[model samples]
Target: MLNDLGGQGAISRAADFIVIGAGTVGLPISVLLARKTGATVICLETGGLRQEEDTHPLNEVVQQGMFYKGASHGRFRCLGGTSMRWGGALIPFQNSDLCNAHWPISLDELTPFIDDVERLFSLEPGPYSDVSFPFELGGTHVNRLAKWPEFRKRNVAALLDADVAAAANLQVWLNAHVVKIKTQTEGVRLEAVSPNGDRLAISGRKLIVAAGAIETTRLALLIDRQNNGAVSALTSALGHNFTDHISAEVAEIVASETALLNKIVGFRFGAAGSMRNIRFELAPQAEARRHLPPGFCHIGFEVEKPGGFDVLREIFRNVQRRKSPPPRVIFDLIANTPWLARAMWWRLVNKRLLFPAHSRLIVHAVVEQLPSPNNRITLSDTCCDRFGLPLAEINWRLSKEDKENVIETSELFRRTWRTSKFASLGVWKSIEPQQIWANIDNAEGIFHPTGSTRMGACPADGVVDKNLNLFGVANVQLLATSVLPTGGGANPTMMLLLLGMRCVNQHAAGSTPPKA
Candidate 1:
């Protein structure tokens, strides 16, 4: 059961395992560990049970190098974490992503866990293979499908099993913000405080820091400082090699045949009620030859003008929010009844969201960033949060090579499309690289922060070893996007969850965790 730390004193102060941050990656692993191994587990969440619109004050940070909207946006501290606000897109990393020396483990080693991760989300169990396209771009590009869960299934917290929640061995505590870690002789002790200023010290035989990327690095830095740099001296690569997926709209397609365009790039409804869409990425051989980082391009349809459908959507939202619809909304809905009826029919019969009668098609592309030591996270000397702990200072920037990769990849995609038989169906308005660079703000990170506390084969290069154990800290492991050495073109959520389950499984089997 979910208990409030501020008001509850019935639960124990310690357990066999203590997981910080009951977010996307933390909640499932905690439940699995408790249910599978029957080990007493406690999960600490900093936020309440519900999602909120405004950013939390503690999430504020100093942006020293680049303007990162994710630093203050899209992050939630609630029980569901950012999964509560995400679009539910799921894609796995390519084999080349792992084989390219970006990760300590290869794709073959991680393949066994993919189906398990998919099952956790109730997705169809199978390998996510490349689908054959109607028109091919020779050996250069491959069409891959990205799956999305139904809207109701997106919040991962709702997917937890009732039996697991009611298990006597598992407890989830909310509003328990951990601020300090004390390394002890046997294990570590965490000192947490509630919003009401109630203090609690929780100790465990093992600890897992599954907070999101930036926050995880910040906490690791805090632990290092509290330990008089003992941790950093061993794991020197703790707060370095930061990376994110940089994306931008590289071109606009004015299609003469909307139906063909839709068939080429529209969202497909699967028999299992999930939505799928095709994205174009370079073939493995082509990527290897180009010597560029991985990236992908997808089609984006924009509603050219607001119609009755949009007004009806607004009215529905207003009603759900318990607010009365405005006079203009009612007037507009009445004015376009015919179009509204057509849209409703299309939605019901086609199982697809209706686009505007005339919509613009955009070619959106996202490129993987080369990890750089300069883009890192550090603690601010002057800035502190409400807990009086130093705030994280994010020093992130796109290098010149990064910008050139975007330009080259975008051009390569355009050239490949031009070679296709269906090229004449659309008029392309391509973007110039010079103009794109001049307006560099057009390109931005997609909120996938990674590589601060990266995994390495040895402690000299990474904070965690192959088993994810902190190098110098016994009985403590770190799990988050921060442990990812590279952010591939695919979303990192599935991979992060897979790693979390792997960690739990290793622990369940009585495998001795690596020591410093």
Candidate 2:
């Protein structure tokens, strides 16, 4: 049940629970929370139902190479979050990502939630699972990527849009931009503004801020600012330790005969482009490790380049101008041989780009960034909202290990490509080591942007504990990308959805929702 906050006399009502940001992570979270014990869950968003914002600002941000100051990852002011046009590229975190002891819990802990998430999103399953565990144990690798014959098609009705809110104990406030959260003696209070000029002050028995990493940190800082001090405890760490996927694309032609080789290097292979085969693989040595430092769970793959350099450059320039870059990440497989892999460079780049029989299939990689305090999001006094909440000034950054992973992963695939049947396909060469760890200057934060207000078992190192409650705040839980202490180099929406489910069950289980 959702009501337009713009309607008169709507700001005085109260809800048992309040969730800000009704997009990707927040939508499912609201649903799960509401269903648990029939709690009244109220969600506040900045956009309305009549309006759709699937691909807002479809301008020329890529080609123009301009700055996307206020732009975000398909950031919707409307409801339904970015799922409306998310490309829905759902992939689960690798075992390495979900197994890190650095995390307060393990993938096993998130197992039940994963099933709920799959059920909620009505996600068509796919593959991936740890060898140590049985496929029936939890969200297995095979089940995750199980061929979803109807992959992109919707299979459930729970997935709603800006027009229709889900049916249940959940109440959505359309076009209500939540600005601040104040912890009152009785409960949590929220200050949300409507598009037409309405300041709704409502109280909730509990509060969750699943407003994406960037926004999550901003909200926390807003609370600290309103309290008359720097955003502290709950940890000044609220805005520190951020990580995002580091990605880059390179293109070239598949020298002849390579097509046959790719066929031999099958399995784990699929075609996204016409006749253009995309080969994705982990380092032959990329097995799960109990320890490899944090942020080590990452994936890399390449695609063949499709269009003219000028055409692509122009398109990218336009995308940059509009602050919306199309997925420039591409991949190609050629790691089978060492000598052949090195020779790949000579066959291509001789004043001509390399390409496969098909169009430009780019070889792309998703690398993880180690958590560092330097890559932080801080409040900007210069940019304040009408109600005095400080706007988020994200100093986007990355680490060196971030880049090495990409190179290593690519090289690993290169060696496999060389030894594989297609070792002599077209000319393939070494990845020129684009942007490596710490030098992160890719497309801002593409598919995955995580860790602003991370979750951990201990209060000293993180903002929210495993239960996802803010470390020093009482009854305040978070539901944003920041909840992920490390984003395991996979698309985050699926995992975020799973976490929301976990929170719902725990909150309803009489666990006394962790103290602030």
Candidate 3:
């Protein structure tokens, strides 16, 4: 039953298993455990029942080590977790990504869980129809991604309202923040605080910390501090190897060619109430020959607004004329002109009603970042959050090789586009690598954070073992993206869903809660 923790005075506080953060990973794990194993499960969510104005404070953290804007942003502190803002693009990792040497487990082990993830989400079967791109398109492959929130309901809401509704043994505790955890010989004790500053302690026979990348990593560091390095990995590497996809706009195609490219790009209606967006992945052969990491280019339409193109042309001409006018002057001139405003309005109306094509093709590149030990999250010495826990000081770093791979991948795409006769990029200027790299400071990290508590064969290399149990800590498990050893070019959502299923099945096998 989904009840507020404040009102659970009559119910049993102890449970057979405890799962933290009822987001994408936590929700499914709790449901599977309750129904499959018939174990009494308690799910703790620090966020409130729903999104409200005052809940943002709970998510506040101090930004250090490379200064990511998403450190405090792009994360939802509600029951559904970050899925509240998820775009629902579920792209699986390439097979090559699964074969990386760092992975203690192989791709074959994870293949069976694909069907389970699909069925759990109620996704239509055989929705991804393979559309092969032309052979001449050397750098990109034809791939598809289906949209989520099918039938106008969020995935988490649908799962709770349908799949988990009949699970009588599962208890969801909302607005319960776990501030400290103490591991005992038989079980784990968690101390959580409510929104009203009331403290509550809950115990479980087994515990899983699935509170996403940032929070989970923070908790691991806290545990190490509390236990005096007893629970932490030997190199004090609990919060190292932090990574996210580096997204950048590398180039733009001409306005007139947008319609032709749209035939090969963007999303289309699919069978079984699904939507498929064609993606052009860097071919494995191409990646090998060029020594490039996994990267893909997605084409999106950028509508030409009233004051944009004119300002660009004016700025270009100003450079030619040696006239140094501020950009604000040009914007003010366009904003104040009545005729220009009307022209922009007519263009908007025509595009909306007359089926007019887009103005430019915006090419976005999503690149895989190699795991570097220096790029990490550490505990802040001087800062703490509202809960008095040391804030996660993220030291996000991207190697020179990472940036160069993006540049090389973009260059390959430019060369591939030139050979395709279907579209013509007339009167276009090629954007240079340095130009794209110049904006690295402003480029926001993709919200997918991984590798802080990576999985490996032993604790010497990673925080968790192959089964995702933290080494030396027998009953504690991690089921979030933080346990991912590597971040591939594809979105991490679909792969994470599969991993969550694997954890439940393995944990349920002969696993029993501790005696009360």
Which one is best on TM-score? 1
Candidates' lDDT values, in order?
Answer: 0.78, 0.55, 0.69
Point to the candidate with the largest lDDT: 1
Residue 124, model 3: lDDT of 55
For candidate 3, the per-residue lDDT at 75 reads: 70
Badly placed stretches (over 4 Å) of model 2 are: 50-73, 129-158, 161-168, 228-231, 250-358, 399-401, 421-427, 431-442, 511-516
lDDT of 3 by residue, 25-120 (tens): 787788888876778898988887666342377666666556676666767666767665556677677766766435888767877887777776
Q: Is candidate 2 or candidate 3 better by TM-score?
A: 3
Which candidate, 1 or 3, would have the higher lDDT against the true structure? 1
Q: Whose lDDT is higher: candidate 1's or candidate 2's?
A: 1
C-alpha-based local distance difference test score of model 2? 0.55
Candidate 3 positional error at 57, Å: 1.7
Query: Where does candidate 3 have its weakest 10-residue lDDT segment?
Result: 349-358
| RMSD of model 2 against the true structure | 9.9
Give the candidates in order of TM-score, highest first.
1, 3, 2
Instruction: Give the runs in model 1 whose Cα sits over 4 Å from its true position.
Output: 8-12, 161-164, 287-290, 307-354, 511-516
